[model samples]
Target: MTYDPTFDQTRLDQLADQCLADNTGTGKVIFLSDDEDNRLELTSWRFEDEEAKARLMKSDFKLYLLELLDTLLVYRAQHKQPNASRGVVSVCKNQMTVQWVSRAEAERLRDL
Candidate 1:
């Protein structure tokens, strides 16, 4: 499978919409995944309450994110980028940024 930037952007937009719908006050949402693993981690916080993070930990958005991550992993594998061991999708104020990073970077973000 090849990477489709447009598709990724569209998916990210949908995810952001879902997050906002789940929590109208959602300020940011982050999705992290390692290409070598099936785990997809999420970090989210409300604009009004940064201290209260992970509000979406148990939200249904995870299922959507998992499917998106699976597709992204397939594309990453086909592209074969050694340094791109992880995929990060971030949404803030309804804007999305998608990136590929190293395992170390992923771990650091996961810890945040």
Candidate 2:
């Protein structure tokens, strides 16, 4: 059996905005747990903050943003963007972190 509870896209977007306001990128993961035995593995990607910022300020950033936008559009098409019904359930944990290039992209991940 599988269960998935959608999250509030607006909240995710707001979180992303907060991160951007701090000049940072962010990501989120939703853990669905009830009574189950399971294990999860997550792979991470990282970059030097200063270098990433420098790159984002260049012409290439447009292409990068476009790609991200395309992805978000696809996600929205597949599943309607969630409403503000669910609050974020978890914060950064286990020394793991996420960073998003844009708030819209983060909203796309709200239900995942």
Best by TM-score: 1
The regions of model 2 sitting more than 4 angstroms off are 1-58, 82-112
TM-scores for every predicted model: 0.60, 0.25
- Would you give me the overall lDDT of model 1? 0.56
Off by over 4 Å in 1: 22-54, 81-84
Q: Cα miss at 51, model 2 (Å)?
A: 19
* Backbone clashes in model 2, listed as residue pairs: 26-99, 26-100
lDDT of each residue in 8-27, candidate 2, tens digit only? 34433544444333344223
Q: What's the distance in Å from true for residue 18, model 2? A: 18
| Best-fitting candidate, scored by lDDT | 1
User: Ten-residue segment with the worst summed lDDT in candidate 1?
Assistant: 44-53
